[model samples]
Target: MTTPESALPMVVPATDLPARVRIHEVGARDGLQNEKTAVPTSVKAEFVHRLADAGLTTIEATSFVHPKWVPQLADAEDLFPQLADLRGIALPVLVPNQRGLDRALALGARRVAVFASATESFAKANLNRSLDESLAVFDPVVRQAKDADVHVRGYVSMCFGDPWEGAVPFHQVVRVCKALRDMGCDELSLGDTIGVATPGHVLELLSLLNEEGVPTNVIGVHFHDTYGQALANTYAALEHGVTTVDASAGGLGGCPYAKSATGNLATEDLVWMLQGLGIETGVDLGKLTATSVWMAEQLGRPSPSRTVRALSHQE
Candidate 1:
């Protein structure tokens, strides 16, 4: 009993929704980086290839952090070279410090991301430094990357609520975001690391960021689905004029530092919603879901995405 296109339910998008949205696919780097078992370098390369084939223009390839911290991506150096031929794709890598940056630069990485925390407790736990200290550390890294013509993205974690420090103050989040922008980060991704944010929280944060003079165009949202609020929060962000949305394929990531944090908003799920809303993302829903299903098998787990489950059942 399929409904005809003309008879299907109509969705009136909020006036603020952009004509096109940039999906920042963080599956390879952010997704796999948190897996307990290390993914094979060959499989990782194939993952990136499949994502690119699915028309994800901006895919985060890998992280250059020390293997001691994120052993799941220990093969970052080996995995990067295999992706050299992805033409017209922006493959950004995560670099924790100058050492990580050096490794990425050596691999000819054209784009890199640095991480910061909006909460002092998370900062101390995640980076082993205070918020100010973490910003200082990334300053040189961003500067060096920009000087080398490499694009830089700054990630501000725990933007909505912190586990240790509940309901993080608006000023705290704004300060970190401003610091990242001041450090010359080309873009900033506000992370709801613990997944406690509601639409109201998201809207409030965006408003404050706007009030602080952070351009909406350079802002992105990364939400975790722990409490099933990721999509709701994402919609809130989109309605507030955020053009960039970060998602992981198969919903394959969680925060190591924040134990309660869950997998990210699945790319398949986000794509389904975006396409349904007539928002252009240039991602093939069928292909992206197939890729996630394949990757899930390789990991011996079912994908965490509801859209993937529904689509797979149809087959």
Candidate 2:
């Protein structure tokens, strides 16, 4: 059987490189949100500190979504206060709507991410609104965030493929991204929510984004590992001048829409690759893996990260 890496297109180093590539650790928020068991607030705070210690400049602290929607993150108010105690850390929270943003702002969140989808089905299922309607709903939130001087990131989900609607149109993804940009979003993250993207598709869409005059610096990639293609996809995006990438520790995330799919790219695996390529992630691979393993033990299950598995066995 051919592996995912085998199927990936050959990587050609880009002639021009960006000043730096920033990897935002979303393990504490996105990673843990989908977990079956609720991780304790202390564990979540410690995990955030650990990720910061491992040299992650930006860490998604938590979401302010309703506890009824995500009981796992019921301690958002408590969690937000803890971020104040940790210095030199840029923490962003996931805000689903104006209410969510209000909660985050009240808690002193400096940055917020609003999520929308390129596919209609995903938008409806994920947020109970149509794609266009969701964008319309986000209009006020974006305006308010800008007025509040809070940095806002717009997440375009199913940019590659949607479980409900396979092979999302590139034009659709571009349309949403452009709308978000026009709405004053500081950055946009093209998300592979189901991990079904290939290197060819990524290059094609990236080329489209470039043609549309979307600045590469403000664009990021959030790839899932459902088909084990996250790393290859990351390398492809990096070659295309994508400067920011979102990943989770221990491969700990999943889409509620895609039942059989895996989570985001593992931070441990991503850092390992970057380090091997002489890239500076400023993250300690060993310590990162140790933190992942500890979380795995707490969850009473082994992490899905390949790097963590390999490194943990040596201990």
Candidate 3:
């Protein structure tokens, strides 16, 4: 006997969800690198260690960019070596240029990420180059990293919206994504740098990328929570077959280049939703939230993550 449609239970479509989602924790590098005060190298190492202890397999450790640009991460050389012995964790460092790649390679980095902007305004503001010019600069860096047998992740920022240029076109984002993939990037992460994307926009962009032959499996989503749409956008991406999602512990960092940008989607928050949805993330929420609370105390501020705050209050 068929029940009436109204009597059917409301359940999330199983076919629309992934069995396992990989949460790429970026709090160490993307989170702390934007802070005004410098974090001690020891504390940074401890933070990474704690995240690993919480079963976060992929933790972005640090960036090897020029000290003049991101002085907060000037201790990358000292930091990378300390994390070398961490078992079962993939530590990816951000390399802005060939020089940065050389520094990372010298320290035995196994994975590195290169960034590119999807809009001309962001390119000029962040990299001091035009859109095409920035991609040109990252070309050799990606190639060299590939030659060194180091995995490379390509990040395209300002994918949905830009502070200087409003409402970026979908084609512009796809072009950059294809360029990154063609340059040997093992995976491409689309960044909503200013955090203005909605779920509708995310679905449209991912759909367009799929139509253009970009494999959704090799694509990741990086969202900021400025507009409170990060989680919604992430859900949309996951529905579209994107399995990798970038998040920060405690919602730690924002883009310095994009002033209006806010903290990233918190890893704890993401985990909470994923766990409720029956998705396997291999993370311990208790330990992850505790780590965020500890880091927040070190920073002398409360965490922006709602899950962390609620869990901390309960404790």
Local distance difference test, per candidate? 0.91, 0.86, 0.92
Models 1 onward score TM values of 0.95, 0.93, 0.95
**Taking the tens digit of each residue's C-alpha lDDT, what string does model 1 give over 63-161?**
998888889988988999999999999999999999999999999999999999998899999999998899999999999999999999999999989
lDDT by residue (42-69, candidate 2, tens digit) is: 8898888878877788999888888887
Which portions of model 2 show Cα errors greater than 4 Å? 1-19
- Supply candidate 2's per-residue lDDT for 134: 97
* Candidate 3 Cα errors over 4 Å, as ranges: 1-15
> Which 10 residues in a row give candidate 1 its minimum summed lDDT?
1-10
RMSD of 1: 2.7
Candidate 2 Cα lDDT to native: 0.86
Instruction: Determine the backbone clash count of candidate 1.
Output: 0
lDDT tens readout by residue for model 3, 57-102: 9999999989999999999999999998897799999999999999
